[model samples]
Target chain A: MALVLQTVDLQKRFGGIVATNDVSLSIEKGARHALIGPNGAGKTTVINLLTGVLRPTGGRILLEGEDITDLEAHKRVHLGIARTFQINQLFPDLTPLETIGLAVSERLGMGGQWWRLVGSKSAVVEQAVEVLDRFHLADVMHERTATLPYGKQRLVEIALAIACRPNVLLLDEPAAGVPEAERHDILAAVAALPKDVTVLLIEHDMDLVFSFADRISVLVNGELFVEGAPEDVARDPRVKAVYLGEEADA
Target chain B: MMAAEESGDASRTLVAQANAALAARARWSPLEIAFWLAAAASIFLFPTKHLILTEIAILGLFALSLDLLLGYAGIVSLGHAAFFGFGAYAAGLLAKYHVVNEPVLALLASGIATMLLGFVTSFLVLRGSDLTRLMVTLGVALVLREIANRLEITGGADGLQGIVMDPILGRFSFDIYGHVAYVYSLIMLFALFLVARRIVNSPFGLSLRSLKGNPLRAAAIGIHVNGRLVAIYTIAAGYAGIAGALLTQTTQFASLSVLDFERSADVLLILIIGGTGYLYGGLIGAVLFKLMQDWLANLTPQYWQFWIGLILVIIVLVGRDRITRTTDPIRALVQRATDRVWSGVRGSG
Candidate 1:
């Protein structure tokens, strides 16, 4: 499979401390890739660099063979790259349906047409309803996003990113705040997405990472420790010592 | 299924009507549109009302200019009067000394001068938070006022007088009765409103709205947040300048009153009363404010300001947003009935 996004020799530093050091990684088109590390291992920094939220000290970001190192975050979004935050970034005053409508409107380049508002567009409204329904959010579609339960909020954020119809989707700790009961539903929704969309997930739950990731990359102290298929990486003693503890293995 | 479908159809019809009504209200109600049109119509019909209406028109345009930045772009300024005063003084000085023979050219010069001033002041606005921004803008206006006071050529504390606007288009004389002046001011105000409305509905305006709603989100989405704000500020300043020039052209005078804190406060109060983010809000506020002033002064000339302040406080206490909230259901019913009647007329046609 052709690679869709690849980072070459990425480096970032804060004062004297290096956050990401020469981290080279590639995400194959349509592959489900997971990046995992202990807290402060700079997994989020990698996501930030790729999404143009933060500039790297040194590195190149290649999207579909074109280097997009200096691109702004919004331009990257327009170029078919979208990322959900570790914390939800939703329009709190807007309903779930309204939030989705804004995203879809932006994706379709109709955001500028105030006279052609989102509520007036039947097709866009129906599509927003379908997206909310996919995550069992139809009941609360008209409810403010801030009023939804935490798990549902997380689901809505994911739904918003997906609604962009992006070729590549980035999810940062999508299940971090989710409850045990809803985790299955969340996983099923993620798994059921169209096969053409590539995903880069940052997840801490070992069972989730192992089951969902087509390939796993382990980061340690701002460096890549190892990357391989989930089973082989699970077997690696270094990964277990650093990422998967004895309790996790048991 | 039949009952559910019937209700769905009913609600859809209700919603479509509500949507249309809301759109109309958002554009300002038909009554307001008719009122302005009627007022414009009367400028020709009633010669006596022309001068007062022209002042109203100029002030309304000034208030609208402030609303463009304050209401839509979310840039609060306590010193917009700086641009107004500058434009008034520019056009007044030009006309007094016969530097410009053409009134339109003088008006144009006044606007361009104020835009240059705005371009310089925009950098100050870019670096400050909202509170800081307010103070800085106020400081800029105060400084400009002081400079005007120091310069004898600008009439200093006495204010510039005897501003003889050259014949508009080299034809209509600005008489003491203000017939030509009123027409000139109305035409200018209408043009500014059209331009303001067009800009507010444009792509740039949408970006400004997005920036207002969430700056961080706007930045993430690739909007140059600061750049958009500075550009909007400059445009609003240009409008303010034109409003100032119109005032001088109508009054045959330019005064320190244009730069006073009361002018800014009055505009702010008008925006609050009429509504914000809606184009008509500023114009409506101006008419309501000036008419109330006239009526109150007639009743209690000494305590008119006190009564106006009380009205403003009541408006703020009631929650401005709640006061302006759409009562869509009732309006929607009437709108649908009207729609049917219109379609019937079209059918006959």
Candidate 2:
């Protein structure tokens, strides 16, 4: 499979503490890859590094064989790396339609057109509406996005990433804080994503990880402890021991 | 997904509805037109009060500039008067030297001059906390005020005097009654108001609102956050400069007081009174603020400021949102009545 995103010996240090150790990862194009780790396993940090939110102290990042380590965060997005936050980082005042419209306009390179009205371009509105409809956000699209239920807000987050038309989509805990009833809708939406777009799902839910990922990379203490198919990783004793031991400690 | 034929029909309906909603919002409502008409009528209705009306128009434009930064982009500056003073000085120098003595061209040049200042100082505001931005902006204004105070050409502490504005369009000399000044300032205010309205309603303006909502998310979604802020800041600077030029042109003088802290504070207070976000806030606030200031000063010349402070405290205690909410029903009622009257006229026609 063609590789889309790769990190080489990535490291991040805060004062004396190591947040991300000498870690390397590769995400294959069109692969449903899940990055699973415990609460402090540096999963979110990895997402931040890939999206250029946090610069790696030591290491290089590559996108489609390009050295994107030094690229700006928004430029990384322009180069087709889009991410959702672990916690929803959304415009509280913007409606879902506007939120999605902004992404679509930015993607279309019409973001700097100060003279054009918001709905002057029908293509943006069409795509924004399409993405909202796809994520089942059409009914409540007119309301402020923050007022929506957590599940729908999460869906809006995903829809924002999708509207950017990214080559590699990073979903940081798409189901986090979602009600159980609304979570299956998220799963359905996640599963129905376009086949060509590569997805890197950072999730704590084993059900989501197992059911969705074709390839699973288990992280333990900022290190890649296991990498294999879902079944193989599921069968691995180390992965089970870490979870069961943590469960026992709890 | 629904079947091909059905989904296409549904999506089409959706698209049309969205377009209609957006178009309606972007359309010029009758109320907005009526507001401008009323503003225009004030010139004729209170012809003897043109001097104060001119001041109100200038103050409104200045307030609009601040709203562009604070309301849309969430960049608050306590030193916005820097641009105003820069423009004031630029205009005074231009007119005093007879370099581009025509008022409109000089006004544009003054705007460009302030835009340069804004562009340079915008970088300083980009990296700091709000407090840092505030101090930096205030410092800029203070520094300029000091520079103007020390300069020979600017007339130092006594202010630039003997500046002459050319009769607008080679005719209509600025009469002593201030008719020309009020009309000229009002026209500029109206023109600039249209531009600001268009900008705040545009895609770029949407990006600006996003910046205020969440800068991090704005960047994550491919918005160059700093770039957007700088652009808006620079534009607002240009607007403030034009407003400053109006003060210079109408008064035929530029003073060190143009860059004073109170000017910045007064514009901020005007925005608070008018509300922000909506473009009309500045204009409405300017009217209320100038009128209140006029009335209070007449009532108690020695302590009008104290009363203004009390009024602001009352406004804050009652809450801006609650005030708007209380007026919502009245606004809706007017909107409905206007809509019916408009439809009736169209139907009869």
lDDT (0 to 1) per candidate: 0.81, 0.90
Model 2 residue runs over 4 Å out of place are: B1-3, B334-349
TM-score, cand. 2: 0.97
Where model 1 places Cα greater than 4 Å from the true spot, the runs are A1-30, A37-45, A55-71, A78-80, A91-168, A174-198, A204-208, A219-226, A236-250, B1-29, B41-49, B93-109, B150-155, B295-304, B325-349
Which docking band does candidate 2 fall into? Answer: high
Model 2 iRMSD vs. native: 0.8
Model 1: per-residue Cα lDDT over B136-232, one tens digit each: 9899999999999889998889999877777998998888888888888888888778777767755466566667776655555445667778788
lDDT digits (tens) for residues A15-104 of candidate 1 = 899999999999999999999988889999999999888899998999999999998787888888888889877656556766676666
Worst 10 residues of 2 chain B by lDDT: B20-29
DockQ computed for model 1 against the true two-chain complex using alpha carbons: 0.23
Candidates' TM-scores? 0.76, 0.97
